[model samples]
Target chain A: MYQDWIWGLVGGGLIGIAAALYLLVNGRILGASGILGGLVDGTERAHSKERLAFLAGLVLVPVSVVPFYSSVDTHLTPNLAVVIFAGLLVGVGTRLANGCTSGHGVCGISRLAPRGMVATVFYLLGGGASLLLFKHVLGVI
Target chain B: MRALFAFIAGGTFGTGLVVSGMTDTTKVQGWLDIFGDWDPTLAFVLGGAVVPMFFAWRYTDGRLPRLGGKFPAPPEPKLDHNLVLGSLIFGLGWGLAGLCPGPAIASLSYGGFGGGVFLIAMIAGMLAAPPARRWLDAVAGSS
Candidate 1:
């Protein structure tokens, strides 16, 4: 329905605003992967407190807001092996590349940075190819 | 105060992911499944997010740093094998699972067993990346 599109736009806009806020106030890029990565990888020790606080908010806000919004249907793949493989690829890939959708796609592209643009293009191409291979060639979904 | 702002920013970002249906694996997959029953909603979400962000970038240009913190240095524009290779690997995984880091974490509360599994695996993979990167670099250098 059109409502879904509207919500998507509004929600996306909010995400941009959040990124902007982080940039304006914190003077940092609002990259989900980098923030989380720094914590787990021991690379962001100096800013651990800030990272922890941001993650706490990221998790908590969603939990609180769930009561007001309709229950979200996640539709994650049911296969455990596939899920694990996918997770590993995403985790390793994002770190190796130094960004993900939020960091590279949204934040990177907005600034018109070449690295961000290049990453985004490659990932989308990769996603597209994977979809074709899995869905059409492999027929595994 | 810094933490508070970070918290607010994170909360807002999470809400946006949830509201935009970015947390839904099917929707994400749908966008990638362009040859199949493709859903256009994700495109709208991307478009909407980019508009304000575009302006944000422009505004920050040639301005003093705000909030008493140093602005991030512009990322080095070096094009390397790792960038392309990593992105390819990431894309394949994204298409397969339809859950990236942001939605994956945000959906944890509601995503049940599958979500837990994916998160644990992701963390493990992240922990492994440093060594992997080192090994990769070693191989590249040796060759």
Candidate 2:
């Protein structure tokens, strides 16, 4: 039950299926950031209802399902400043780049898109380097 | 309609996030921490997602979406500064918090205080990004 990688694969398969369905049915890339960021930035008002529906499912399903299995613990950082700073960077960065893990990491790479591949490599490098700086050096993580 | 399909996809994605342990910040941080006691779970998750999507892309070659609109065109091949710089910044945030957009949103169901704070800050940042992006485009074009 605790075999994390196996479950990771299963769950990932589900995610892929989700993406696949979105493309096949809706004729759009199922990027979480784009779906939500469009609303946040007001660039997607034309599809706001659809976007909101997507988000509602994204938020509510987890809320509804997690209780049936077990309560989740995110183990987010206790430090308030770190949380805020990290959130800000993720928001700004994802919006500016027009993608995130869902868009660039999942959908982009699967299609072998160059932009997605490049973004993934850089972000991985950035993440690793950040860990080295903060976790290894400063012991912050 | 399109909205119904979108909702189903979102729900499935959310379920996947929960089941895959993607919502667990420690798991994400562990995956990022190469020098430390690194976790390799995220690799499986990523690879698993890509495999099906690979076929999905091929299947869409000449097919129209069942609902209405055309599929998303292939992404532009050009690599831009915004793409790289923004990704790097995003990565820094990911490494710092071990949470990206999908999981960050999903985790809100149970992420408690810290999660709430993160969401608010993220939205604020999203709001600030547009003007900054326009400024960047202007500066780049002029240079």
Candidate 3:
């Protein structure tokens, strides 16, 4: 059986390499939310084509892999209402904060930027607390 | 050339999300569920990603990017109410759904109807952010 952590390490390494390549070549942070968010808000119109191209690649590559690794699991919540609420929170919050897991957690912390570190800590804390409330306190998740 | 490289970078990143199981909500919730059957895979993923990125950051020190464009300016290091509040909200949402932007988009290929709904809502929320921010700023300024 494939070890979960092993897969994580390998996959994470690829993610880092991708981020590195993006930085080295594009002079931009490989932040998924920031890229997509920019397009949504029309704040990145100048680089809209590039952003679209990146997103196209992001979606296409994974789809191509589905044929071989058909067991890929997304594990999304089944409740539509909850899912919608969660989506809204993520969208608004990430944009308001100007980062997300990729932008802040991966790229930001790697650079030892205080903003990244602080944001990461807060988000983790928030996530942990929410899990406690939802899973333990309310028993609703 | 820029578009091509962007595509390549995104493709590689998507593969990483899939390979690392970051696309799976169960694993994500497990990581957050400290009181339950917590899994450490996500931690490993973060650790593994940081290794190469550390070198990448170092390599860029006092140097221009190979593509001849100015590197993005570093964000201000100040701590503020908005930063903390925004992150807290985001974290709550992340824990609730067990999916973030990267995994959400990458999983769309096979994520079915639910994925489509989440993506549309997420985009709508993103579109609403600027107006919300402006409102918040106005409120903060008044107070």
Work out the TM-score per prediction: 0.95, 0.95, 0.95
Q: lDDT of all the models against the reference?
A: 0.86, 0.87, 0.86
Report the lDDT tens digits of candidate 3 across residue range A17-56. 9999999888889998899999878788877877888898
Q: Lowest summed-lDDT stretch of 10 residues in model 1 chain A?
A: A65-74
DockQ, candidate 1, vs. native dimer: 0.78
DockQ winner among the candidates? Answer: 2
Model 3 residue A45 lDDT score:
82
What are the per-residue Cα lDDT tens digits for candidate 2 across B36-71?
888888888999898889999999988898997788
Q: Give the CAPRI rating of model 1.
A: medium
CA deviation > 4 Å runs, candidate 1: A66-70
Instruction: Point out the worst 10-residue segment of candidate 1 chain B by lDDT.
Output: B62-71
DockQ of 3: 0.77
lDDT of 3 by residue, B64-109 (tens): 8887788888888887766787788888888888888998999888
Task: DockQ each candidate and list the results.
Answer: 0.78, 0.79, 0.77
* lDDT, model 1, position A34: 88
Alpha carbon lDDT at B18, candidate 2: 90
